[model samples]
Target: MKVLHVITGLGIGGAEQQLRLLLRHLPVRSSVVTLTNPGAVAAGIEADGTPVTHLGMTGNRDLGALPRLARFVRQGRYDLVHTHLYRACVYGRTAARLAGVRRVIATEHSLGETQIEGRPLSAGTRALYLASERLGTSTVAVSPSVARRLAEWGVPPERIRIVPNGIETDRFAFDAGARRRTRQALGLPEDAHVVGGVGRLTPGKRFDRLVRAVASIPDARLLLVGEGEHRAELLRVAGECGAADRVLLAGACEDPPAAASAGPALPELLAAMDVFVSTSPDETFGLAVVEALAAGLPVLYVACPAVDDLAPEAAPGARRIGESVPELISALRGIRDARLARLPLPAAARRYDIARSAEQLMTLYDQAVHGTPLPAK
Candidate 1:
């Protein structure tokens, strides 16, 4: 079927990258429309042989963009419209109805208890979300945690489908040659214990706490893989704690199968690390934690619904930690002193494989178009 995917922006964030990965495995003919900045992930998507259209939306209230987007959708005569992110959901769903497309789907990628996409949730925001939500056929939550949050916010339980965010598992498999090369390229000592975290360097992510925790451990280095407005503050925190030289704020790296010019892709960095840590106390799915588990690295996380919702045996290498710097430091020291070897790829990693997620999504697409009932979970 012909499907058009709409999103707020094609930047290097979790939702954007996830879309790129999903398109690679989906069986239907799919195109993309980005309402704003079409950054690295957009380029990667185009490189993978998909047509990407930039909607050139100036700001949130760009009323002019609505007509333009609606006109484009009508011209394409798409069989279905799938929207991602917040702004896209509101506008895309409305525009799809205007363009006479009835089968519309929205995937809520980042929804937390107090925030939607790192922004504080307000009464007006909820009203707008709920109002726009009615225009779509269904909403897909990336995890059971996000599904619960949506239901609590008044979305009908029947409208919410749990389709967990997935990864190209084999792409993240540990590689010995990549480990040595990546460490040397990043100027890390071969014997030094590397503590790695991957996410937007945001205040909510609590990466500053990770820096301080790594600082307390002598000879430990911090490798943060994403970029954000919080970068300067994190650097200042590192310098204040006298760990400036021990930290590497490697700006956003693409997911694996990335071009050589994109610098070290995420898997290479994962290969060079001794342990993975997620300082964010509020996470929808904890996708990075799953990726780390696929790399066979032991994980210490403050919050990971992806792992927490699963049975303990699903991810034996992952450990949930408390939300304090002292607790983080102690956990790091414990893992370091123990010199834990890389564990086996856990069942959680296999469960969230991208191919499986694509199959589940295709089932939803079939249900939407053919009036077929979804199979029992």
Candidate 2:
């Protein structure tokens, strides 16, 4: 089937990386369309042999862009149009319907409560979101928590499907050689007690909390990875926490796989770390946490709906915390080597393999194609 994926812009985030893997591995004719000019994400998609489009949009609500997209979808006669993020879902679904495409699917990757990055929306933007939900046939939530949030936003529960983002667990499996090679390449001390985190420098990520927590741990160094607008602020926070020298800001690495841009690769980085730390307030699904488990690295996560649900049986290395700074400092100090080593990360990660997640998505896509009802949210 000729399938089209519409993403706002394939920035190196968890949802974008998951889509990258799915498009590369799925045995289907797929192309990716980006609303804005493509960057590293597009380059990675191109490397995988999937076609990429930069719709040349200057802003979110480009008027002419809509007809242009509608015409393209009409001409391609696409079997399915699946979208990621808010902008693409809004405009992509609207255009797909205007083009008379049979199916349009949208996946909610981030909880809307925290997804807003800039100015609060004006009235028109809110109206557009409401309209987009009506046009899309099926809505997929990255986690059950997201599904619950989507329902609160007026999406009928029956129209939503829960398909937690999948990871290629094999990519995360413990590799002692990789640990040695990566550390050697980066010039880290052989005995460094590494603490690592992966995410854009965003307020919701609570990276500042991590910096504070790191200050409470002895002989610990931190690796903060990924690129975003908040990089400067994060650096400032590190200084505020007196952790400047103890932190290594990789900015962002230009890894060809681009998988290194997020998710399992971050866990691979965790393989070299003694502990993994995430301070994100309310994660839909702790993809990086699972990746850490897969790499046999213990983690300390701020309690949220998704983190609370991550079965300890799967992540024996995971510890949940309420919103307390003292609690975080204590958690960091309490991570003993034996306890961290006991977490069955590989076994835990095996259950979240992308192959299984893809099959479930494919089933949902098949049903969407025939205008069939989605599972109850």
Candidate 3:
């Protein structure tokens, strides 16, 4: 089937990279449209042979974007329209309907309890979201927690489908050669205990707490991947905690399958780490924790619906810790003292495989187009 994906931006975020990965595996003709910045992920998608169009949407209030997007949808004559992220869902749904496309699917990638995509969820936001949601055929939640959240927000339970975000599991498999090279490239001591976290460097992620926790451990070093507004604040927090030198902000790294970029790829960085931690108390899906588990690293997370919702045995290497610096310190100490070796890849990793997710999504797409009944959760 011919599918067109609309998204807010093609940046180096989970949803964007997930789209790129999905495009590679999905057995359908697909194209992409970004409502704003077409960044690194856009390049990667194009490199993978998918056409990408930037809508040049100036801001949330850009009414002109509606007609422009609608025109593109009409011209493409897409069999289905799949939207990702908030702005794209709203505009893409409207545009698809305007273009006479009835089967529109929206995947809510970053909706949290109090926020949607790291921004506070005001009444206006919810109103717009619910209103636009009515235009779509189905809304795919990245996790069960997200499905529940959508229901609480008044979305019809029948319209929500749980298609967990997936990863190319083997790409993240731990490599001993990569570990040595990455550590040496980053100037990390071979014996140093590296504690890593990957996500947007936002306050909600509580990366400051991670910096402080690593600072308390004399021999532990913190490696933060991904970039955001909180970089300066995190550095300041590191200085205050006397761990300024120990904290290394590795900026953003693209997915491993993407074309080689300047920085170290995610799997390489994962190889360099001893353990992984996710301090965010609010997470729709803890993708980084899953990636760490795929790398066979023991994971310490304050909240991860992806792991918590699954059977414990699914992620044997992941441990849910408390949401405080002291608790983080204790967990890190426990890991250090135990001298835990790299873990075996977890069942959870295989469960969320990109190939599996693509197949699930393709089924949804087929059902949506053929007016077939959706399978029960």
Task: Give all TM-scores, in the order shown.
Answer: 0.99, 0.90, 0.98
**What residue runs in model 2 are displaced by over 4 Å at the alpha carbon?**
112-126, 253-268, 303-306, 336-339, 346-348, 370-377
Report lDDT (Cα) of residue 239, candidate 3: 92
For model 1, the local distance difference test gives 0.94
Where is model 2 poorest over a 10-residue stretch in terms of lDDT?
255-264
Q: Write candidate 3's Cα lDDT for 238-350 as tens digits.
A: 99988889999999888854665666789999999999999998888989999999999999999899999999999989999999999999999999999999999899999
Q: Which residue pairs collide in model 2, if any?
A: 293-345
- Distance (Å) between predicted and true CA of 280, model 1? 0.4
Error of 2 at 93 (Å): 0.6
lDDT of 3: 0.93
Q: Model 2 over residues 84-178: C-alpha lDDT tens digits? A: 88788888998999999858888888654545323353556656776888898778987778787778777888788887777777666677777
Report the Cα lDDT for residue 281, model 1.
88
User: Each candidate's root-mean-square deviation in Å?
Assistant: 0.9, 3.0, 1.0
Which ten-residue region of model 1 has the weakest summed lDDT? 254-263
lDDT accuracy of residue 91 in candidate 3? 97
Error of 1 at 155 (Å): 0.5
